[model samples]
Target: NTTAAAVAMLRDIPVHMSYSIAVIDRQGNYATVYVNPDRPAEVVERRVSTNHQHGVEWAWHAETTKSVEREAAVEKLLLASASIKDVLSGFQRPPAYQIQYGHDCGTLYTAVYRPLDASVELVWPGSLWRQSCADFQDEVRTIRFNDGGSGGLAPTFKEGAVSS
Candidate 1:
């Protein structure tokens, strides 16, 4: 997966490029990449997220007010963040900043990846867990609802950790 590859690359080399990469492992381990072409070897080492947003190779999706609001919220957090944890906090639920796809889709989990520690914290709609990079596997974790309320698309998982 691209996200896994990105995290692995970050661990092994200086990833400086023009694009964004988001990776999450089975244990909710994740890494988001923000690259700048001008500085092709420097990693910002921060947290970032994306949802249905367009990129260089993709066309912009139909933007709704909600999507714009979510993007704005993320950007605001990123700009005001003083630490990586602060940025990760933006993905937390309650106010429902995390996106849900509706009855057929729901917010399954939110993840935070710390490259410095090579650790990932996962937030399920009803639970939470953490995993280390060394223990991570390229497998998807599935959560089954007891109420037969099946909803949520599992995010992809990637392997490897960032080594400073």
Candidate 2:
């Protein structure tokens, strides 16, 4: 019911471009809705989008290699009970994970949400943080980024002790 309500809410919003939204209820039931100006909203169990429309069949709409590879990786990740760490660790290379350069798109952060526990986990360069709706903690920390192409972990922060 919640997923249906969420989908209905998206239908009322004005869309300027193609995008997908995944909603999961507390019961672990989820719905992924794809919306585009070219066609009606569609529901899929899993989908990936990147500046390309999936609603309409356009000869010009090409799926980037990045998107294709990611889609396949995501499919494998989704098949198992993957944790936030599992998902984050899965994207270990270019396209899915990029370091910001002169003017290229770089992955800033990855977030995982748990509807049942009302919790969210986030991963940055070399840092991992998680918080629950019931026990939110705010702290100041620094993360360093390795702009150089060294095969070492960069943008790392000291693991601070977390209290519940």
Candidate 3:
């Protein structure tokens, strides 16, 4: 069912495009669909993608150096059973994290999802959002970014309950 849904979604996009999408459900069911322009979709369980065509030879497409680095780091983290916090930190690593104010495409936020609980935590430069299926409240938890222009520094996560 997951695979079918993923394929349907992929087909919805106009053809002749290289893309990847992660589809997940609260029951721990998930699928990542990869498609190269003019090619069929393939479902991959363990993969790292950053705006490039996957499931193909590296020489066939242009995968940025930073994307490669981040993918490798994620593979290592997945092997080590890293927590969501650690994964998010890895994403903030050099060349991967971006905060260009004037750029059209820069890192705006990072998200951590625990499908079993249907909980998601979204982290931005100055705030965080945490919610679960049980509690539908919408709130933004402000946090401090101590990077000082340096990348890869994890935001100073706050303790205690979220404030209103």
Candidate 4:
């Protein structure tokens, strides 16, 4: 049931890569995907991957707390969006994104809240789904850099590099 919930969630989300959802448990655990025998059956908290751990445990907590705060702000904007003017007020503002869950497998739930300056919308559905989430920040950064530069960041790595 968890597997199905996970898969369903992944399927529901708008993403490019073909993926399967895997629910991670409380003890930093997630069931294995049988599709890849070589891959581990479990992914623990941060056994998954992250750019950097907080300098301290509390630091991480502080960040999580900040995220929850940001989440609340985003939700508030969505709830208060009664007019297009309200939506366009922050039209160019970046969105605050987050994913949260309770338990896994049975009635699993994963949500992606994208609250831009525009009208905020949320997709809270059963399943853990994300694609290129981490890279999105980098993508934004790239735009900023390129916009500031005369031209743009050149593509250093060629797609054909691996063909030979």
Task: Give the alpha-carbon lDDT of every model.
Answer: 0.51, 0.61, 0.60, 0.31
Residue 63 deviation, candidate 3, in Å?
7.1
Q: Candidate 2: how many backbone clashes?
A: 1
Pick by TM-score: which candidate is best?
2
The residue-level lDDT of candidate 1 at 138 comes to 57
Q: Give, for candidate 3, the lowest lDDT window spanning 10 residues.
A: 55-64
Which 10 successive residues of model 1 have the least lDDT summed?
145-154
For all predicted structures, in order, the TM-scores are 0.44, 0.68, 0.63, 0.25
Sorted on lDDT, highest at the top, how do the candidates line up?
2, 3, 1, 4
Q: Candidate 3, 61: how far from true, in Å?
A: 10
Q: What would the per-residue lDDT of candidate 3 be over residues 54-141, giving only the tens digit for each residue?
A: 5335632334344565566667766776576676766665445644333333455677776777788876644567888899786545
lDDT of 2 by residue, 1-164 (tens): 48878888877777887787878888877878888777778777753443333433443333323445455566666566358567667654454555543234345567777888899877775566888889888755454444545453333334555544
Off by over 4 Å in 2: 47-65, 80-84, 137-164
Sort by TM-score, best first: what order?
2, 3, 1, 4
Candidate 4 lDDT over 36-125, as tens digits, reads 223323322221111112222355643643434444555566578877546433221322322221111111122333322212232222
- Residue 104 displacement (Å), model 2: 3.7
| Cand. 2 TM to true fold | 0.68
Please estimate how well model 2 matches the true structure, expressed as its whole-model Cα lDDT.
0.61
